[model samples]
Target: MHIAEGFLPPAHAIAWGVASAPFVVHGVRSLTREVREHPESTLLLGASGAFTFVLSALKLPSVTGSCSHPTGTGLGAILFRPPIMAVLGTITLLFQALLLAHGGLTTLGANVFSMAIVGPWAGYGVYRLLRRWDVPLMVTVFFGAFVADLSTYCVTSVQLALAFPDPGSGFLGALGKFGSIFAVTQIPLAVSEGLLTVIVMRLLVQSSRGELTRLGVLLTKSATAAAKSGAVAR
Candidate 1:
Protein backbone atom coordinates (compact mmCIF):
# COMPACT_ATOMS: atom_id res chain seq x y z
CA MET A 1 0.00 0.00 0.00
CA HIS A 2 1.23 3.45 -0.92
CA ILE A 3 0.42 6.50 1.17
CA ALA A 4 0.16 9.34 -1.33
CA GLU A 5 2.16 12.54 -1.05
CA GLY A 6 1.21 15.00 1.69
CA PHE A 7 -1.14 12.51 3.29
CA LEU A 8 1.04 12.11 6.37
CA PRO A 9 1.78 15.09 8.55
CA PRO A 10 5.31 16.39 8.22
CA ALA A 11 6.18 15.22 11.70
CA HIS A 12 4.97 11.69 11.09
CA ALA A 13 6.74 11.58 7.74
CA ILE A 14 9.98 12.79 9.21
CA ALA A 15 9.77 10.42 12.12
CA TRP A 16 9.21 7.44 9.87
CA GLY A 17 12.03 8.47 7.63
CA VAL A 18 14.35 8.73 10.57
CA ALA A 19 13.23 5.36 11.85
CA SER A 20 13.77 3.63 8.53
CA ALA A 21 17.26 4.97 7.87
CA PRO A 22 19.10 2.39 9.97
CA PHE A 23 17.25 -0.51 8.40
CA VAL A 24 18.02 0.80 4.95
CA VAL A 25 21.69 1.03 5.79
CA HIS A 26 21.70 -2.45 7.23
CA GLY A 27 19.95 -3.77 4.16
CA VAL A 28 22.49 -2.20 1.86
CA ARG A 29 25.27 -3.77 3.85
CA SER A 30 23.54 -7.15 3.80
CA LEU A 31 23.06 -6.98 0.05
CA THR A 32 26.62 -5.92 -0.49
CA ARG A 33 27.85 -8.83 1.59
CA GLU A 34 25.62 -11.19 -0.36
CA VAL A 35 27.07 -10.02 -3.64
CA ARG A 36 30.63 -10.41 -2.44
CA GLU A 37 30.08 -13.78 -0.77
CA HIS A 38 27.93 -15.38 -3.42
CA PRO A 39 28.32 -13.84 -6.81
CA GLU A 40 26.23 -16.70 -8.15
CA SER A 41 23.25 -15.17 -6.34
CA THR A 42 23.36 -12.16 -8.65
CA LEU A 43 20.85 -13.60 -11.08
CA LEU A 44 18.41 -14.74 -8.42
CA LEU A 45 18.68 -11.42 -6.59
CA GLY A 46 17.93 -9.52 -9.80
CA ALA A 47 14.99 -11.77 -10.49
CA SER A 48 13.75 -11.20 -6.95
CA GLY A 49 13.93 -7.44 -7.40
CA ALA A 50 12.11 -7.67 -10.71
CA PHE A 51 9.43 -9.81 -9.16
CA THR A 52 8.95 -7.29 -6.36
CA PHE A 53 8.78 -4.44 -8.85
CA VAL A 54 6.22 -6.16 -11.06
CA LEU A 55 3.97 -7.36 -8.26
CA SER A 56 3.98 -4.07 -6.34
CA ALA A 57 3.43 -1.97 -9.47
CA LEU A 58 0.06 -3.60 -10.06
CA LYS A 59 -2.11 -1.55 -7.70
CA LEU A 60 -5.76 -1.47 -6.63
CA PRO A 61 -7.50 1.58 -5.28
CA SER A 62 -8.38 1.39 -1.59
CA VAL A 63 -9.12 4.25 0.81
CA THR A 64 -8.23 7.82 0.04
CA GLY A 65 -4.62 8.43 -0.97
CA SER A 66 -3.81 4.77 -0.60
CA CYS A 67 -4.20 1.40 -2.29
CA SER A 68 -3.91 -2.34 -1.71
CA HIS A 69 -1.71 -4.77 -3.61
CA PRO A 70 0.28 -7.92 -3.40
CA THR A 71 3.72 -7.31 -1.87
CA GLY A 72 6.32 -9.71 -3.32
CA THR A 73 8.72 -9.07 -0.46
CA GLY A 74 7.76 -12.33 1.19
CA LEU A 75 9.21 -14.51 -1.54
CA GLY A 76 12.48 -12.64 -1.56
CA ALA A 77 12.66 -12.63 2.23
CA ILE A 78 12.06 -16.37 2.24
CA LEU A 79 14.93 -16.82 -0.19
CA PHE A 80 17.26 -14.01 0.84
CA ARG A 81 15.99 -12.90 4.25
CA PRO A 82 14.38 -9.63 5.33
CA PRO A 83 17.55 -7.54 5.30
CA ILE A 84 18.07 -8.17 1.61
CA MET A 85 14.36 -7.74 0.87
CA ALA A 86 14.46 -4.36 2.57
CA VAL A 87 17.05 -3.12 0.08
CA LEU A 88 15.30 -4.50 -2.98
CA GLY A 89 11.85 -3.47 -1.79
CA THR A 90 12.95 0.11 -1.23
CA ILE A 91 14.44 0.24 -4.72
CA THR A 92 11.22 -1.12 -6.16
CA LEU A 93 9.15 1.43 -4.24
CA LEU A 94 11.43 4.21 -5.36
CA PHE A 95 11.07 3.23 -8.99
CA GLN A 96 7.32 2.98 -8.69
CA ALA A 97 7.23 6.44 -7.17
CA LEU A 98 9.46 8.15 -9.75
CA LEU A 99 8.80 6.23 -12.95
CA LEU A 100 5.25 4.93 -12.70
CA ALA A 101 3.80 7.78 -10.62
CA HIS A 102 2.17 5.13 -8.50
CA GLY A 103 3.44 5.92 -4.98
CA GLY A 104 4.89 9.16 -3.76
CA LEU A 105 8.45 10.24 -3.08
CA THR A 106 7.73 11.98 0.19
CA THR A 107 6.11 8.89 1.65
CA LEU A 108 8.81 6.46 0.52
CA GLY A 109 10.08 5.88 4.04
CA ALA A 110 6.65 5.04 5.43
CA ASN A 111 5.91 2.82 2.47
CA VAL A 112 9.24 1.11 2.76
CA PHE A 113 8.69 0.50 6.47
CA SER A 114 5.36 -1.16 5.95
CA MET A 115 6.06 -3.16 2.79
CA ALA A 116 9.76 -3.79 2.86
CA ILE A 117 10.59 -4.12 6.53
CA VAL A 118 7.46 -5.25 8.31
CA GLY A 119 6.06 -7.43 5.52
CA PRO A 120 9.25 -9.34 4.81
CA TRP A 121 10.05 -9.90 8.47
CA ALA A 122 6.58 -11.21 9.19
CA GLY A 123 6.52 -13.49 6.17
CA TYR A 124 10.02 -14.78 6.69
CA GLY A 125 9.29 -15.45 10.33
CA VAL A 126 6.24 -17.49 9.44
CA TYR A 127 8.17 -19.37 6.78
CA ARG A 128 11.03 -20.25 9.09
CA LEU A 129 8.67 -21.35 11.82
CA LEU A 130 6.74 -23.56 9.46
CA ARG A 131 9.86 -25.02 7.97
CA ARG A 132 11.13 -25.86 11.45
CA TRP A 133 7.86 -27.66 12.11
CA ASP A 134 8.29 -29.65 8.92
CA VAL A 135 5.36 -28.19 7.05
CA PRO A 136 4.88 -29.16 3.42
CA LEU A 137 6.91 -27.10 1.01
CA MET A 138 3.95 -25.74 -0.97
CA VAL A 139 2.00 -24.96 2.19
CA THR A 140 4.90 -23.08 3.73
CA VAL A 141 5.43 -21.06 0.58
CA PHE A 142 1.74 -20.12 0.33
CA PHE A 143 1.57 -19.02 3.95
CA GLY A 144 4.79 -17.05 3.64
CA ALA A 145 3.42 -15.06 0.70
CA PHE A 146 0.00 -14.70 2.22
CA VAL A 147 1.31 -13.57 5.60
CA ALA A 148 3.71 -11.11 4.04
CA ASP A 149 1.02 -9.47 1.93
CA LEU A 150 -1.42 -9.28 4.81
CA SER A 151 1.21 -8.00 7.22
CA THR A 152 2.16 -5.17 4.89
CA TYR A 153 -1.43 -3.94 4.78
CA CYS A 154 -1.73 -4.21 8.52
CA VAL A 155 1.31 -1.98 8.99
CA THR A 156 -0.03 0.43 6.41
CA SER A 157 -3.31 0.63 8.28
CA VAL A 158 -1.46 1.43 11.46
CA GLN A 159 0.61 4.10 9.77
CA LEU A 160 -2.47 5.74 8.25
CA ALA A 161 -4.34 5.60 11.50
CA LEU A 162 -1.47 7.10 13.41
CA ALA A 163 -1.16 9.89 10.92
CA PHE A 164 -4.87 10.63 10.63
CA PRO A 165 -6.87 9.37 13.53
CA ASP A 166 -10.58 10.00 13.78
CA PRO A 167 -11.43 12.83 16.13
CA GLY A 168 -14.42 11.18 17.78
CA SER A 169 -13.36 7.51 17.67
CA GLY A 170 -9.62 8.08 17.87
CA PHE A 171 -6.69 5.94 16.67
CA LEU A 172 -8.20 2.51 17.22
CA GLY A 173 -11.34 3.42 15.30
CA ALA A 174 -9.34 4.81 12.44
CA LEU A 175 -7.21 1.69 12.43
CA GLY A 176 -10.32 -0.48 12.25
CA LYS A 177 -11.74 1.56 9.41
CA PHE A 178 -8.54 1.47 7.40
CA GLY A 179 -8.02 -2.21 8.09
CA SER A 180 -11.56 -2.99 7.00
CA ILE A 181 -11.15 -1.11 3.75
CA PHE A 182 -7.95 -2.97 2.98
CA ALA A 183 -9.32 -6.34 4.02
CA VAL A 184 -12.06 -6.13 1.41
CA THR A 185 -9.47 -6.06 -1.37
CA GLN A 186 -6.39 -7.44 0.35
CA ILE A 187 -7.68 -10.81 1.53
CA PRO A 188 -8.22 -12.16 -1.96
CA LEU A 189 -5.06 -10.56 -3.26
CA ALA A 190 -2.98 -12.18 -0.53
CA VAL A 191 -4.37 -15.61 -1.38
CA SER A 192 -3.76 -15.00 -5.06
CA GLU A 193 -0.22 -13.88 -4.37
CA GLY A 194 0.37 -16.91 -2.20
CA LEU A 195 -0.80 -19.32 -4.88
CA LEU A 196 1.10 -17.49 -7.57
CA THR A 197 4.26 -17.53 -5.49
CA VAL A 198 3.87 -21.23 -4.95
CA ILE A 199 3.69 -21.73 -8.70
CA VAL A 200 6.73 -19.59 -9.24
CA MET A 201 8.60 -21.45 -6.52
CA ARG A 202 7.70 -24.74 -8.15
CA LEU A 203 9.03 -23.53 -11.47
CA LEU A 204 12.21 -22.30 -9.80
CA VAL A 205 12.61 -25.60 -8.02
CA GLN A 206 12.47 -27.43 -11.30
CA SER A 207 14.64 -25.10 -13.32
CA SER A 208 17.11 -23.99 -10.65
CA ARG A 209 17.37 -26.75 -8.16
CA GLY A 210 21.02 -26.01 -7.67
CA GLU A 211 20.31 -22.43 -6.78
CA LEU A 212 17.48 -23.48 -4.49
CA THR A 213 19.80 -25.92 -2.80
CA ARG A 214 22.36 -23.20 -2.46
CA LEU A 215 19.68 -21.03 -0.92
CA GLY A 216 18.96 -23.88 1.50
CA VAL A 217 15.41 -24.26 0.32
CA LEU A 218 16.16 -27.66 -1.15
CA LEU A 219 17.99 -30.49 0.52
CA THR A 220 21.57 -31.16 -0.55
CA LYS A 221 22.52 -34.54 -1.93
CA SER A 222 23.61 -35.92 1.42
CA ALA A 223 20.55 -34.61 3.18
CA THR A 224 18.25 -36.10 0.56
CA ALA A 225 20.01 -39.40 0.78
CA ALA A 226 19.78 -39.37 4.55
CA ALA A 227 16.09 -38.49 4.39
CA LYS A 228 15.42 -41.33 2.00
CA SER A 229 17.33 -43.73 4.21
CA GLY A 230 15.41 -42.58 7.30
CA ALA A 231 12.14 -43.03 5.42
CA VAL A 232 13.13 -46.51 4.35
CA ALA A 233 14.09 -47.45 7.90
CA ARG A 234 10.82 -46.07 9.22
Candidate 2:
Protein backbone atom coordinates (compact mmCIF):
# COMPACT_ATOMS: atom_id res chain seq x y z
CA MET A 1 0.00 0.00 0.00
CA HIS A 2 1.11 3.52 -0.77
CA ILE A 3 0.23 6.70 1.04
CA ALA A 4 -0.27 9.54 -1.39
CA GLU A 5 1.90 12.62 -1.25
CA GLY A 6 1.22 15.07 1.58
CA PHE A 7 -1.41 12.76 3.04
CA LEU A 8 0.20 12.46 6.45
CA PRO A 9 0.51 15.32 8.88
CA PRO A 10 3.91 17.02 8.90
CA ALA A 11 4.59 15.85 12.43
CA HIS A 12 3.58 12.31 11.66
CA ALA A 13 5.67 12.19 8.52
CA ILE A 14 8.73 13.49 10.30
CA ALA A 15 8.22 11.14 13.21
CA TRP A 16 7.99 8.15 10.91
CA GLY A 17 11.04 9.27 8.99
CA VAL A 18 13.03 9.60 12.18
CA ALA A 19 11.84 6.25 13.44
CA SER A 20 12.69 4.45 10.19
CA ALA A 21 16.16 5.89 9.58
CA PRO A 22 18.13 3.50 11.74
CA PHE A 23 16.65 0.35 10.24
CA VAL A 24 17.31 1.59 6.72
CA VAL A 25 20.86 2.52 7.59
CA HIS A 26 21.43 -0.87 9.14
CA GLY A 27 19.90 -2.45 6.09
CA VAL A 28 22.28 -0.62 3.86
CA ARG A 29 25.22 -2.00 5.81
CA SER A 30 23.76 -5.49 5.74
CA LEU A 31 23.19 -5.34 1.99
CA THR A 32 26.71 -4.11 1.39
CA ARG A 33 28.22 -6.84 3.53
CA GLU A 34 26.18 -9.50 1.79
CA VAL A 35 27.29 -8.35 -1.63
CA ARG A 36 30.89 -8.10 -0.56
CA GLU A 37 31.07 -11.51 1.05
CA HIS A 38 28.98 -13.42 -1.47
CA PRO A 39 29.39 -11.85 -4.85
CA GLU A 40 27.61 -14.79 -6.44
CA SER A 41 24.42 -13.80 -4.70
CA THR A 42 24.18 -10.54 -6.62
CA LEU A 43 21.93 -11.96 -9.32
CA LEU A 44 19.43 -13.43 -6.90
CA LEU A 45 19.46 -10.20 -4.91
CA GLY A 46 18.57 -8.24 -8.03
CA ALA A 47 15.78 -10.69 -8.76
CA SER A 48 14.40 -10.20 -5.26
CA GLY A 49 14.33 -6.44 -5.68
CA ALA A 50 12.65 -6.77 -9.05
CA PHE A 51 10.04 -9.13 -7.59
CA THR A 52 9.13 -6.60 -4.90
CA PHE A 53 8.93 -3.77 -7.39
CA VAL A 54 6.74 -5.64 -9.82
CA LEU A 55 4.31 -7.12 -7.29
CA SER A 56 3.87 -4.00 -5.19
CA ALA A 57 3.40 -1.84 -8.26
CA LEU A 58 0.17 -3.63 -9.05
CA LYS A 59 -1.69 -1.42 -6.58
CA LEU A 60 -5.47 -1.40 -6.32
CA PRO A 61 -7.72 1.21 -4.76
CA SER A 62 -8.25 0.48 -1.11
CA VAL A 63 -8.19 2.87 1.86
CA THR A 64 -8.40 6.52 0.83
CA GLY A 65 -4.73 7.44 0.78
CA SER A 66 -3.45 3.92 0.26
CA CYS A 67 -3.79 0.86 -2.00
CA SER A 68 -3.67 -2.92 -1.68
CA HIS A 69 -1.04 -5.25 -3.22
CA PRO A 70 1.31 -8.12 -2.61
CA THR A 71 4.34 -7.11 -0.57
CA GLY A 72 6.72 -9.74 -2.12
CA THR A 73 9.19 -9.48 0.75
CA GLY A 74 8.91 -12.97 2.22
CA LEU A 75 10.81 -14.78 -0.52
CA GLY A 76 13.81 -12.55 -0.17
CA ALA A 77 13.59 -12.53 3.60
CA ILE A 78 13.64 -16.31 3.51
CA LEU A 79 16.44 -16.57 0.96
CA PHE A 80 18.62 -13.85 2.40
CA ARG A 81 17.22 -12.27 5.59
CA PRO A 82 15.01 -9.41 6.73
CA PRO A 83 17.88 -6.90 6.94
CA ILE A 84 18.75 -7.42 3.29
CA MET A 85 15.09 -7.51 2.32
CA ALA A 86 14.71 -4.08 3.91
CA VAL A 87 17.24 -2.66 1.47
CA LEU A 88 15.51 -4.37 -1.47
CA GLY A 89 12.07 -3.19 -0.35
CA THR A 90 13.27 0.38 0.13
CA ILE A 91 14.79 0.52 -3.32
CA THR A 92 11.59 -0.90 -4.82
CA LEU A 93 9.39 1.66 -3.00
CA LEU A 94 11.67 4.53 -3.93
CA PHE A 95 11.54 3.62 -7.60
CA GLN A 96 7.77 3.17 -7.56
CA ALA A 97 7.34 6.56 -5.91
CA LEU A 98 9.57 8.33 -8.41
CA LEU A 99 8.68 6.56 -11.66
CA LEU A 100 5.11 5.33 -11.19
CA ALA A 101 3.90 8.01 -8.75
CA HIS A 102 2.20 5.10 -7.04
CA GLY A 103 3.40 6.38 -3.71
CA GLY A 104 4.70 9.76 -2.62
CA LEU A 105 8.19 10.72 -1.63
CA THR A 106 6.92 12.43 1.49
CA THR A 107 5.51 9.18 2.74
CA LEU A 108 8.46 7.02 1.72
CA GLY A 109 9.75 6.75 5.27
CA ALA A 110 6.45 5.53 6.63
CA ASN A 111 6.01 3.17 3.72
CA VAL A 112 9.47 1.75 4.18
CA PHE A 113 8.91 1.35 7.89
CA SER A 114 5.85 -0.76 7.17
CA MET A 115 6.65 -2.77 4.05
CA ALA A 116 10.39 -3.00 4.39
CA ILE A 117 11.02 -3.20 8.10
CA VAL A 118 7.99 -4.56 9.88
CA GLY A 119 6.64 -6.80 7.15
CA PRO A 120 9.88 -8.61 6.48
CA TRP A 121 10.77 -8.96 10.13
CA ALA A 122 7.35 -10.24 11.05
CA GLY A 123 7.26 -12.72 8.17
CA TYR A 124 10.79 -13.94 8.76
CA GLY A 125 10.07 -14.40 12.42
CA VAL A 126 7.07 -16.54 11.59
CA TYR A 127 9.01 -18.58 9.05
CA ARG A 128 11.84 -19.20 11.50
CA LEU A 129 9.51 -20.15 14.32
CA LEU A 130 7.61 -22.58 12.13
CA ARG A 131 10.79 -24.06 10.68
CA ARG A 132 12.10 -24.71 14.20
CA TRP A 133 8.96 -26.70 14.92
CA ASP A 134 9.65 -28.85 11.80
CA VAL A 135 7.03 -27.36 9.57
CA PRO A 136 7.21 -28.40 5.90
CA LEU A 137 9.34 -26.04 3.80
CA MET A 138 6.68 -24.98 1.32
CA VAL A 139 4.08 -24.62 4.07
CA THR A 140 6.34 -22.37 6.07
CA VAL A 141 7.10 -20.41 2.92
CA PHE A 142 3.42 -19.90 2.19
CA PHE A 143 2.69 -18.57 5.65
CA GLY A 144 5.81 -16.40 5.52
CA ALA A 145 4.67 -14.70 2.34
CA PHE A 146 1.09 -14.52 3.56
CA VAL A 147 2.12 -12.79 6.76
CA ALA A 148 4.47 -10.44 4.96
CA ASP A 149 1.77 -9.27 2.56
CA LEU A 150 -0.90 -8.88 5.26
CA SER A 151 1.34 -7.29 7.86
CA THR A 152 2.23 -4.41 5.57
CA TYR A 153 -1.43 -3.50 5.29
CA CYS A 154 -1.86 -3.79 9.04
CA VAL A 155 0.95 -1.32 9.61
CA THR A 156 -0.41 1.00 6.95
CA SER A 157 -3.79 0.96 8.69
CA VAL A 158 -2.10 1.93 11.94
CA GLN A 159 -0.30 4.77 10.22
CA LEU A 160 -3.46 6.09 8.61
CA ALA A 161 -5.50 5.69 11.77
CA LEU A 162 -2.92 7.59 13.78
CA ALA A 163 -2.79 10.39 11.25
CA PHE A 164 -6.56 10.73 10.98
CA PRO A 165 -8.36 9.30 13.95
CA ASP A 166 -12.18 9.28 14.02
CA PRO A 167 -13.75 12.29 15.66
CA GLY A 168 -16.48 10.33 17.43
CA SER A 169 -14.76 7.03 18.18
CA GLY A 170 -11.07 8.04 18.42
CA PHE A 171 -7.99 6.02 17.37
CA LEU A 172 -9.36 2.56 18.04
CA GLY A 173 -12.41 3.19 15.92
CA ALA A 174 -10.30 4.67 13.16
CA LEU A 175 -7.98 1.68 13.29
CA GLY A 176 -10.90 -0.69 13.03
CA LYS A 177 -12.34 1.15 10.06
CA PHE A 178 -9.09 1.27 8.16
CA GLY A 179 -8.17 -2.30 9.05
CA SER A 180 -11.54 -3.57 7.88
CA ILE A 181 -11.30 -1.70 4.61
CA PHE A 182 -7.84 -3.08 3.90
CA ALA A 183 -8.79 -6.62 4.85
CA VAL A 184 -11.41 -6.72 2.12
CA THR A 185 -8.71 -6.83 -0.54
CA GLN A 186 -5.64 -7.80 1.45
CA ILE A 187 -6.66 -11.28 2.51
CA PRO A 188 -6.95 -12.66 -0.99
CA LEU A 189 -3.87 -10.78 -2.10
CA ALA A 190 -1.93 -12.33 0.77
CA VAL A 191 -3.00 -15.84 -0.22
CA SER A 192 -2.15 -15.21 -3.84
CA GLU A 193 1.25 -13.87 -2.89
CA GLY A 194 1.88 -16.88 -0.68
CA LEU A 195 1.16 -19.30 -3.51
CA LEU A 196 3.20 -17.25 -5.94
CA THR A 197 6.16 -17.24 -3.56
CA VAL A 198 5.95 -20.99 -3.21
CA ILE A 199 6.07 -21.36 -6.97
CA VAL A 200 9.12 -19.16 -7.22
CA MET A 201 10.78 -21.07 -4.41
CA ARG A 202 10.08 -24.32 -6.22
CA LEU A 203 11.72 -22.97 -9.34
CA LEU A 204 14.75 -21.92 -7.36
CA VAL A 205 14.91 -25.32 -5.76
CA GLN A 206 15.20 -26.91 -9.17
CA SER A 207 17.45 -24.39 -10.90
CA SER A 208 19.57 -22.90 -8.16
CA ARG A 209 19.86 -25.81 -5.81
CA GLY A 210 23.51 -25.07 -4.99
CA GLU A 211 22.84 -21.43 -4.26
CA LEU A 212 19.81 -22.32 -2.18
CA THR A 213 21.82 -24.83 -0.26
CA ARG A 214 24.57 -22.29 0.35
CA LEU A 215 22.00 -19.84 1.60
CA GLY A 216 20.61 -22.55 3.85
CA VAL A 217 17.26 -22.50 2.12
CA LEU A 218 17.84 -26.14 1.24
CA LEU A 219 20.06 -28.92 2.42
CA THR A 220 21.65 -31.10 -0.22
CA LYS A 221 21.69 -34.84 0.32
CA SER A 222 25.47 -34.83 0.43
CA ALA A 223 25.50 -32.10 2.98
CA THR A 224 22.95 -33.90 5.10
CA ALA A 225 24.97 -37.06 4.94
CA ALA A 226 28.14 -35.21 5.88
CA ALA A 227 26.40 -33.65 8.84
CA LYS A 228 25.24 -37.08 9.94
CA SER A 229 28.75 -38.52 9.62
CA GLY A 230 30.15 -35.66 11.65
CA ALA A 231 27.57 -36.20 14.35
CA VAL A 232 28.39 -39.91 14.44
CA ALA A 233 32.09 -39.14 14.75
CA ARG A 234 31.42 -36.74 17.56
RMSD of each: 3.4, 3.2
lDDT of each: 0.87, 0.88
Q: What is the C-alpha lDDT profile of model 2 across 1-234, one tens digit per residue?
A: 688888999999999889988988998999999999999999999988888877886765553555567989999999999999988998888888898886778899999999999999999999998976668999999999999999998999999999999999999999999888775569888988999899999999889998998998787788778867887798
TM-scores, one per candidate: 0.91, 0.91
Tens digits of per-residue lDDT for model 1, 63-169: 34456678888889988999999999999988888887766778988999999999999999999899867799889999999999999989889999998899999
RMSD of 2: 3.2
lDDT of 2: 0.88
Window of ten residues with lowest summed lDDT in model 1: 59-68
In the predicted model 1, the residue pairs found to clash are none
Q: What is the number of backbone collisions in each predicted candidate, taken in the order shown?
A: 0, 0
